[model samples]
Target chain A: MNRLLAATLLSLVSSPVLACDAVQLGTIEVEQAWSRASIGTSRPGVVYLTIRNAGTEDDALVSIDTPISGMPMLHETVVTDGIASMPHAMEVPVPADATVALEPGGYHGMLMDLTQVLKEGESFPVTLTFRNAGEVTVPVSVQGVGATDAGCSENNG
Target chain B: MRLTRLQKALWVAAGLAIVAFGVLVTIMNRAPEPAAQASFRPTFSLPDAEGRLRTAAEFEGKHLLVFFGFTNCPDVCPTTLSEVGQVMDDLGDEAEEVQPLFISIDPERDRELGLAEYTNAFHPAILGLAGDQAQTRAAADSFHIYYEREDTADASGEYSMSHSPALYLVGPEGDWLRQFTYGTPASDIVSDLQSRL
Candidate 1:
């Protein structure tokens, strides 16, 4: 009975880990990384995630690399006077003890010139380089074409 | 000077006619103006994916759902187009009455990048439109859509085109119907279109 119970518990513990969850590195915790399924491979893809800094010192996301795209850069979408413009962001600042969210219509990681099509229900790895925390690779769940959030539960299937 | 019965009856009829006329005028004045009267009716004459020239007049009997964006857009454009695809799906059989047009603000690059393939990835009902610089500017001006190319280019010698993100709805008679702001849910748009249809 003890052996059977252990097996069941092990499966339960491993299940959630398989899903796109959180990854911790040093004082930074990255979670809820996700991207929408790309419509075309020629068009650029985007990644949105949240970074939480627990340390006293501030950190900034210096660079991002993903195998899906050759060129990954930080971009901010700004809307002014009804015109939407996306300017390249050199880095995203993560203040100490604060959470910075890279979401839709705001800050996002632009995956330029995607090497492959991002299909729904698939997850990919993106390595984010932070000035203080170094490099932390997190799995990004691919949601529906129009999904606004990571929705890890829904994408787990 | 009292009038005879026939004269008195005619005077009463005239008085009632004047009151009815006054009420009619008041109702007319209070009625809401047509949407086209309140706003400009946008028009576009551009080339489709097949390089066929298409004009606003061709879709006079159907509702036009227009969005201006470029193929190279990373986030907002794709998200909005996906929502539009969902809206078209939710519309079901009623979808035939609707025509969705994705006008490329960056016509040169969009044409080279295959505008049709990009839009078809979202929904087949969406017709990708592109034109020369002058033609594109004219169409954008008619819709009051502002778009400008950034002066800087990335390492790949590629630049970004900034443009308006609002989705416009035009009636069958080419009247300005409504504008759906960015991030509006597909369900909400479906309900709105159903009511209007």
Candidate 2:
């Protein structure tokens, strides 16, 4: 019993650190935080991630903050009549026991006026605030310039 | 038992009618229904990524894949470009026969250098073309492509573009062959191109 308790405690403490892409705040779990690499001095780099809510209550992503960008805003790309339009979102909802994917051609967080170019194999930090879960910061890995799929299989947190 | 003369005549007539129906079906199957293609005037002379004036006549001997989007578009544009790159990759040496042309709708933001950067990120062989408002409008209008800037509410003054997400496939002589809708898998595109080749 004592050994089992120790193992559980160790897992609970080291889980977040072991999984660089996973962050937990209250019942909100953010995973596979990643962004695409950019060209020379390219501003307006977009960030993608998966937000999962495990709690019994609903939560909404209120805002996002990152020092690398001048303004981090929640945005979604809507394609209607074969025309794509991306508008600044007021908030993205994360309902209970549901998962929302911020992927290419869909919802993504825009880092407006990037201070530095995003390079491949590099990672940055981003803080996401939720209505109920408060806030959680996670490191976002920069994939290749044309990468679209999240490399979640490599690092499943 | 032998049939009577009247019964024999009826049976023969029925057999002939069945054979006629079979022939009609075969004829219908042999002639494939023509695909409805949107006709576009194959004409344009725009500056390529290297700032060299390129015309549709230059690519007369190869299949041209023309895509319209902006550099600021992070979603559909990149996704479609990546799919195009994958198609080229799967084509192997035959990719030389195909020219992927990316035409920017938002010429103000996507300058020559920016167009080069965006296209190079996908495939080196892809040509990124940008032009002034008049040139862009002519190119888009010639192809019947629709694109407009959506005024966003962000204080950063950043806006997104709404453009048709179809990839136009032109023949060697600048004839409209077919078009692929958005999110078409690379394998399907490769097969279509291969069949056409």
lDDT of candidate 2 at residue B128, scale 0 to 100: 87
Segments in model 1 whose C-alpha atoms lie over 4 Å from true places: A1-19, A154-157, B1-37, B153-155
Summed over model 2, clashes come to 0
Listed models, DockQ each = 0.51, 0.45
For model 1, the interface Cα RMSD in angstroms equals 1.6
lDDT of 1 by residue, B1-197 (tens): 98999999999999999999999997897687643245678888999989999999999989999999998888889878888999999999999999999999999889988988888878999999999999999999888778998855645677888888989999999988888888788898899999988
Best by TM-score: 2
Best by DockQ: 1
lDDT of each: 0.86, 0.82
Tell me the tens digit of each residue's lDDT in model 1 across A1-157: 9999987646533342433566899989888888888866887899999898999999999999999998889999988877889999999999999999898888999998899988887777789999978998887777777676777665531
lDDT of 2 by residue, B1-197 (tens): 99999999999999999999999998897668543354554667789876898889999989999999988776778788988999899999899999999998988789833778789899988898888889889888877778988877647566778889888898998888877988888899999999977
Off by over 4 Å in 2: A1-21, A154-157, B1-36
Worst 10 residues of 1 chain B by lDDT: B30-39
